[model samples]
Target: MAAVSLSVSTVKPLGDRIFIKVSEAEAKTAGGILLPDNAQEKPQVGEVTAVGPGKRSDDGTRQELDVKVGDKVLYSKYAGTEVKLAGEEYILLSEKDILAVVA
Candidate 1:
């Protein structure tokens, strides 16, 4: 079967964690073909496809997540642990590693 990169289903995160699907940029193509690996753009952006529940603090209060699933986000160049889902690459990281949300 052919692979589908994006999914509409929901994936709830566990705690203080999030699941993001890195967005692949369009390859620089001249003859309608993709560019070589060296010519591709560096990955720096992704969409939050899943989010964990709020984490509990020492005070017993739940700290809510700043980001939610479907939110476009920016992360550090070397941040996040890379993961694979449904044959696609994903990133698992804490909210701290995320630099900003793309609005």
Candidate 2:
């Protein structure tokens, strides 16, 4: 799907999902040589730009998400749907897919 240019107000993740702004892969290694496009690893960490209204519990009450907007998170690689909006990349994934929140 074509990504919509992101703004916290423009996109709201549904259910237990979240919107994450993926960090760019490093263009160069520690040695300073630029890595080719094929050599860069997929980034698993990102800043949460937006979040859903929270998931429903078995009792039908809303359960809060562990991560909030502006929280840095580590997610499973190849877990979420990828979208590019106005040349910027973002991911939409369920909260369960998030591995951890970075301190």
**Per-prediction TM-score, please?**
0.75, 0.87
lDDT of 2 by residue, 10-57 (tens): 888988999999999989999999999999999999999989999998
In model 2, the worst 10-residue window by lDDT is 3-12
Q: Which lDDT values do the candidates have, in the order given?
A: 0.82, 0.90
Model 1: per-residue Cα lDDT over 39-93, one tens digit each: 7876889999888887889999889999987899999888878877667888888
- Judge candidate 2 at residue 96 and give its lDDT: 90
Give the winner by TM-score: 2
Model 2: lDDT of residue 93: 97
- The residue-level lDDT of candidate 2 at 99 comes to 97
For model 1, the stretches where C-alpha displacement exceeds 4 angstroms are 1-11, 29-34, 38-41
